[model samples]
Target: MKAMRFTPPGYGGRRRDPDEVKRDGWRKQGLLAVSLDDQRLTWPERELVRQLGERLYGARLDKTEDKR
Candidate 1:
């Protein structure tokens, strides 16, 4: 019997030579890359995306604001 060790997300036992995160996802899971507007994301995931977007870009547009 072997005990499983839990590692943090980025520091886990992943390949070092080449990053397998996106490649494996594209190959195995048939899932594309990250999308902030993906409907499959949960509320927390959406919030994280929103925060990251605002952090990188400017603040999000208000819903009440009209786009010309």
Candidate 2:
């Protein structure tokens, strides 16, 4: 597993990289990545990742509502 940096929301007043966010979303769907540090993640964010991983392995994600 690659050790990707997990940037917390609103860190240092710096905006997150959109590309990085997209990459992380892809990685979560594959379940091939893990957070480098849990302490930096909020509870809901962690849960969202967990659910995404489960959905990725268990069922097809619904794309009907996703405009991207």
Q: Pick the candidate with the highest TM-score.
A: 1
Q: Would you list the clashing residue pairs of candidate 2?
A: none
51 in model 1: Cα distance from truth in Å?
A: 0.4
Task: Encode model 1's per-residue lDDT on 1-68: one tens digit a residue.
Answer: 87657776767565554335666878998965556766889989988877877897779678899865
Model 2 off-target regions past 4 Å? 1-32, 59-68
lDDT over C-alpha atoms for residue 18 of model 1: 37
- 1-68 per-residue lDDT for model 2 (tens digits): 88758767676566668657767878787524545246668888887877886877664347675543
Per-residue lDDT value at 5 in model 1:
75
Best candidate (score: lDDT): 1
Please provide TM-scores, in order, for all candidate models, with all chains considered together: 0.39, 0.33
